[model samples]
Target: MTTVRPLSCPHCGGKEFSFPDKGRCRCLACRSEFLLDETPKPSPARPSGGAGPRRLAALCFLLLLLAGLLYALAPAPAPQPASQPARQRAATPAVTYELQQLALAADPTRDGAPLVLRVRGGLGQKGPAGYVADCYDPRTQAWSEETQRLQDAVGKNAREIRFQAMSDGSLFLVLDKSRLFSFDFAARQWVDARPLLERQPRLAGGVVQIEIGYANEGDALRVMTADGTRRYFYPAVDLAPTYDELRRMVADYRHPQAERRHGFTFARKGAGTSGPQQLIRYAFLDNKTGPRLFGGYLEWDGEGQARHVKRHAHIFRQAHLEATDFFTPDRVYYRASVAWADKEDLIISFRPTPHPDAPSLLQSLDPEDGAIRWTLQCNFDGELVKTADGFYLLQGAKLFRISEGRRPLAEPQRLF
Candidate 1:
């Protein structure tokens, strides 16, 4: 509705006004009517105080209201929980093989290690006494002679018992009679491996050397005479081999006179490879330098024909075992034969302790250059069988299952 502006009527000059129609206005006092001017009056020139600032303030107020409404209506960002500090990762146990002289001053492996076994079996039980076998039960911290009862009667007469490891986590008890008995840890049973080891070549320390592992049908057994003058290889078999049957299986005729006259032992055949390749080890005792080892790898086909041959030696040069190692203050007092060897590595015994009762060091070396790879203070006296995970160290009558771990070298807890 438009407001009628009062005007002096033309007849009576009245100031009163009224809206008689949509656009006409009437003056009541003078009874006069006229068209109403509905146009808005132009705003007065900005007041002395300036209305421009007032308009701007109103616009700002509206923007603020709109922002507040949006903030309230929109979903709130996750609480974020006051930005909790990042959780630190759990620390891994620190473990290292002590290679430094300072770190090895005190033997940590034996100081308080729980006794797992005590050798009670001996060769005198019948003939020349063999080592007594026992096992350590970590759960009970007690020693038990579980291995002694599992052997065949012949195995009981061996001068000493040896651990022959297989890739499938099976263990072979190699008796002195060139016989083998299998024991499965998972099955907790003994296998009559006597058939597989029938007519085996004699093996002894400081005398004959024998090594056996996986072959196609069963195992590829090897025997080397003390002088390494004669080496015999027996392929996998399906049945117990007769004395004459085994003689024909020996591959001694395939080697050269030089290799036969001296000795060759495999370093690594990558025993993992079930192919036609295998490792041959070479042993030489030069009167001037003492003893040295070499690796000879042979690749052949099903026809028993040679495909490739590689030879490696001088792997222990860094050890200097032939030089001042066993004499000087470097603490290398004694050097022993390899306790473990493969194509790529050689694990040997180094007696560093002057005290006869102290433990010896087990050092792994690179087969290519005899460079020391790692050294662990172990009391096994170069007696052990390796598995994929680590190895079982045989100390006295007890067997300790040692795993490769990162825990710092510290006194073992009284968990035994």
Candidate 2:
């Protein structure tokens, strides 16, 4: 009945529609029915031109400003520490050693150079099976292997082996009680000592023990038999002496008569002569207790003139001197081993019998005054060796060079 504005479907916003009823219309594009009044109408034009674009720009600037404020207020992620390279660790050194039985051989040909004998084999093995002898020179700090094999001559069931250096630059290897082998340095081989052993009359009896000592002439070997007889044989000569005969000979030549003085009896234990000076070590026993009371030494001139007798009363109380040696009657004995370090000092090694837990000690004493110069804690059973180079202590598989200075006992240098 009047001019009608254009109408579109509300569901699909399409201008194309069909009137299904007077008030309802159906969209041809979406095929949805809707009331004619529910259709959307076009928007009217605004008076403010381009205001929406400026408002959108202002909203974007506000969002950026808010984000900047949040970044400033929040703690800036803690500056990550600059990455660094890792540090490396250091390296350690290596130490090497071997467990074995070692013995010292003093070679006169090498000017008292220490020759160590190292026995390599199983402890339970009979005789010399898998046995080898390795030599160590302490002066040079070097090791040398022996080329000769010792299995055949050294014998089975050998418990101990020892080397005795002779005056003629030769060596004697004593293999327990089984056999003896002489080492010829020139030929570099082991020579069976049977021929020399046959030269002694006492060889008919089984040899029980052997000892080496310095006689007036040269190096002498003392052989003991199971029948409680001892015979001294000179390796350089065919002459041998019986125990009693040798005792008489030694008493007449080297030893002085036992003397009683100051309520003690003094018997010579050792003696040495150097040119015009002579020194004699004596074991002084108490007249009543019969135990050794102290250490005594006699100093005299070559003209048979006697010097003052020096008595070391403190020596009896030292740990090296057994308490039994001082207290027990008729049990007077010296467990300490003594060696002459030089013309002036005597080196003594001993362990205290009373304090069995105490360490063994090496003490140097002035023979003239009996004053202790210094003391070193070491193995009492270690062999105290005197060479032209200096004094050495051979204990087990280790060798220590002893210092002769007056300074307090410093750690000894281990040569091996």
Candidate 3:
């Protein structure tokens, strides 16, 4: 008998087998036939208990790494309060304003008296309704309001009203160029001048142009007919000339010479001889390079010759020589609009061309050499009023007192 050994199939690892021949055996589970080998196989070794310590150390390292990741992902803690007190925000600086608004419209007369008018409604639609007048004495800085309401007597049909102050301390109101009223501090009431105006034959039958001037002995209201015939009314004496004066008492005031030169039009002109030097100021406009304003002046000799002509021209965009003209679509022709010279200096006001919405500029220039004395930025265009001590700028519903000093402008003082 041969010695027998336990056998298993190598391909299928089946343990149960059947003997097919003397040297071959067939696996019962896999149905494979193979030669049986009596050789013994070695077994794999099992893990020992010492490996547990290594696994536990690896798990602790993993937990530590996870905690570190979580710590890194978390948000930073709130900042701790400082040992010293916290800093405070800085305070804002105070702003300085330049212009002030008034309740009434103020203008100056030839005799240096300011005429203040208060109109309640629109001048074009409601006329001079609810109107009051005041006479301001610059010498005393006192205001005397008129006693009567002008609208009560004039009525609302007088759509337009113009106030003119005479050299003799009287005020004239021309309503629609058809009706005339005169008042003085003594009269205290408006006197109807239509009767005096009707007395003149030349003004009786036709449409005439009425204007106030210092043509007669004192201030007179002159009425010119369509045919160039003129009549004068002296409110001081209530006198209207009987016959048209062949030779006028005063020659017409001469305007500055305006001539286009060097691609510029002298659109505005002003003449002032009150200063030590006589200057014919002009505002030049050049439409070619956008719109630029050039403030210029011509020094004239007694013989009507130009002694020196100087122009200060610079490039600007959409510069307006006359600020009011920006709103007028028809382009009205004007003789003087921008510049005038007082006893001390040549004053000019114009809209800054570089910035369309910027405030208009008011500048004083030296009468001798045309050097800039000082400059101011005003919101609205104003009329300059010359007085004994200083100048007053009459803007719409606002008054600015300008002193002779080199400083810009002083605080506004309410007149009434």
- For all predicted structures, in order, the TM-scores are 0.32, 0.47, 0.40
Query: Model 2 clash pairs?
Result: none
In model 3, where do residues sit more than 4 Å from their true spots?
1-132, 136-146, 149-157, 165-171, 183-191, 204-339, 351-353, 357-359, 404-416
**Model 1 regions more than 4 Å off:** 1-170, 174-180, 194-235, 238-334, 343-346, 351-360, 366-382, 388-391, 400-403, 406-416
Q: Order the candidates by TM-score, highest first.
A: 2, 3, 1
lDDT at 305, model 2: 40
Cα lDDT tens digits, model 2, 206-289, are 567776544222356667778877777666655466755654443233212333322112222334422222223433222211
1-416 per-residue lDDT for model 1 (tens digits): 66345345555666788986888778887677876554234444455686789999999999999999999999878767465444645554443211110000111233322233222333244433333344454546654646454333333333444444332234555545364555544333445565443344442342244445333212334454556543333323222233344334332212121221222232222333433222233443221111112222322233333323332232333121121111111112243345766554466665654456657666665665555667777654525544332444554433455544322123212222
The TM-score measured for candidate 1 stands at 0.32
* Highest lDDT scorer: 2
Of candidate 1, the 10-residue stretch with the lowest lDDT total is 98-107
Model 3 agreement with the true structure over 268-314: per-residue lDDT tens digits: 22244322222233332223211122333332233223334333332
| Candidate achieving the largest TM-score | 2
User: Can you tell me which runs of candidate 2 are displaced by over 4 Å?
Assistant: 1-101, 119-131, 145-147, 153-158, 165-171, 183-191, 199-230, 247-336, 339-344, 350-360, 368-371, 404-409
